[model samples]
Target chain A: MDKKLEVRDGSVVLKVNPEFYPLDIIYSAAYVFLDKAYVLLDGDLKKEILVKLQPKQKQDLEKLGGEFLNELINYADYKHRAAQTKTIREYLLQRALFTNDPSIIPDDDEEVDYNEILNELEEDDEELDDPEGIAVPWEEKYGQKDEKKD
Target chain B: MKKKIKLVLNKNFYDKKAISQAIKDFEHIAKITILDDEFGIELLQKEPLEEPLKEEFSNYVLGLMKNENII
Candidate 1:
């Protein structure tokens, strides 16, 4: 393992390579230590990043630095896995949505005219089967009810 | 008697806006001057504080960076 930590008086300095650990990952890892330690960032962002951590309570500086390194690794792994599974995740989401509502995925080369379909249904209404006259209008079925029934 | 301390922060890693906000927040405790990237802070009170002013100031700026989503 490369020596990334340098223990100083009551503090530890970490030298991070931006190529391996991105700037956002470093920031995320550093944010975790803010409550436990006084964190300061320096050095060239493009080339190298220097993180200085001084614990609020009495603690081993080397141990704190090691924890910070682990956090960086954790975030880096998370970012890598997210990127790798992005396509599959999108595919799963589309599959789920299509399953829930098939109409969500439009048919290509087929244009649907809802008004035409409605007109066709109206023209075929007379041929529909209604044995008990269930489809009759309410007023036609019962003749208008006595208006002033007491 | 007044105590003075200096902190040099890198522009690439630290946001100037966050640092400015920190300076404003700690203005009551210390007299701060910004020269380039260096902050010259002179303590106004002689008594020891609950936390060291310099470290607390640095922590406050980092907190602001996180709060402002700069980091």
Candidate 2:
């Protein structure tokens, strides 16, 4: 019943102005509805983008139309956030890759002293530094300990 | 009888893949020639294509162009 959407037969058609709703946003929204409906888009690229939503099953046309509109808004918000965080996301990824990769470690960085590092570890370093912790030896951790050792 | 049908589609509004897909619907009976001109993109239909079918094909392409693929 919405002015922008029309219900016909068992499907819904939406005529969205490309100015308010961009093409990429439409695609992202349609991708979510793809499982429930067969989506088709068309329009004179100049002004509006026409979308035809054909349900793959029996359902209420109005509900689906509402969902599509909501999805468009949701996707648009996501796109805006993504654009805003692009630089921060890139920085985060770069930092993660740098810290986790040994090969890429900077040559100017200070050498890591194992004993000094161990001394600086928290008191629970037994659990932090070793695979099996202070309670168990290599063989015991490997399930080869004597049964009577308990 | 063979005839030529010309349909004007907006250049910025149409998708080539959808047009090709629509063309496939009538591939057995028609030959399609696409051209770009001042009035918009032109789809010249050859081989006895009916007016209604041309309209239907246009609508089909329109729907496809609107639904873009996104990740």
Candidate 3:
């Protein structure tokens, strides 16, 4: 049940199962929605950094956070929070470029009018404060202990 | 012939709920523990063990597996 996947720096990880794939998938979804370029992080401690996505994108990501929680039993509690934060960063980039309503726009459009959704997209002041993204400190602290190998 | 069955588990399984679930997953499993978090997850071996079975042991184990949806 508690099989460790990787350990590096200050963290030890176990890959039981990913309860919520969409929280992670939303990053790509937002990129599609916003018609923007983005990258996902896999090196070092494992992080996601979005080069661009607007405030509205941030809001949309948070709203989707609940869907991640509801969709899977594995995401019912604290686990959902961390995945949601990473998704939001990427979503922000999608929010930055625009000229018209994205809902009505076709996916083939070369550009998005982020200005139009600027008002529709809510800004999360807390996210701006934490660029690294939000995760409970306990997951870091408890996840670090090297399990006793016998 | 009697054989020993060993099961390795995660530390989180040390928690009551996780432990109960794993034990219920296998009928012939005799012991489960967290020896190595990295590579010991599939350590459980199913084999016959010499032990007196209580009248309701199978039912009790089955019930736990059913509750955890591991059945």
Candidate 4:
């Protein structure tokens, strides 16, 4: 098999095809390695991208190259799956928000007054029947007990 | 002794604004001159640093690009 990565001068170089890995995906992968290595990108964006990774500490260049390649695949798959589920994700979000609060959805036919709704809620709270005085606080119904001697 | 390093950043890969910001941030440490696609950096201090200046500068530019959402 032909070698895809080049190791020289304590650095690993990868010639990434732009078609297989988009520029954004490459950027995302490169960002993840910023702290671990010195990442330098140079090449034709339309054709091939040359990614150079110089590890901060002593390590195998081949392994570093392999990790970078894996990151590229990881970002590519994430982007692909994100694009595929975008519509569904948006739909689910809409459903969740609407279910949680139907008042958030705008209604063209009816004008809503927030203050009026709040007033109605207050009135409803006042109208609530508490035959057993269950709504009363314990402190309000009973006097505070005297502290026991230590 | 003053040291100088030349870095040629391709227009297709690098964002001009990010490079400008990186240069501005590192101006205290080095005198950076921009000529089209190339950046000429002249070190002001003579002391040996922990990391290579050229690599650090390039990494700074890359960081700026990512932080500014240019890449």
- Order the candidates by DockQ, highest first — what do you get? 4, 1, 2, 3
Output the better candidate (1/3) by lDDT. 1
Clashes of 2: 6
Q: Candidate 2 lDDT, tens digit per residue, A49-141?
A: 877787767888888888999999998899899999996686556446655774653455333542233345434454466555566667767
Clashing pairs in 4: none
* Candidate 1 DockQ, CA atoms: 0.65
- The A-chain TM-scores of all the candidates are 0.63, 0.64, 0.17, 0.67
Candidate 3: C-alpha lDDT: 0.36
For model 3, the stretches where C-alpha displacement exceeds 4 angstroms are A1-117, A120-150, B4-13, B29-71
**lDDT (C-alpha, whole model) for all candidates:** 0.80, 0.66, 0.36, 0.80
Model 2 segments beyond 4 Å from truth? Answer: A100-150, B1-14, B17-71
Which candidate leads in DockQ? 4
TM-score per candidate, in order? 0.67, 0.51, 0.19, 0.73
Candidate 4, residue B1: lDDT = 64
Reference contacts preserved by each model? 0.82, 0.07, 0.00, 0.68
Clashing pairs in model 1?
A: none
Residues A41-122, model 3: lDDT tens digits: 1222223222122222224433333333233344344355766787555446565433344564346543344433454464
Best by TM-score: 4
Model 3: residue B5 alpha-carbon error in angstroms: 6.6
> Residue-wise lDDT of candidate 4 within B1-71, one digit each (tens)?
67767777766777778878887888777777676544444444345568877778788888888888888
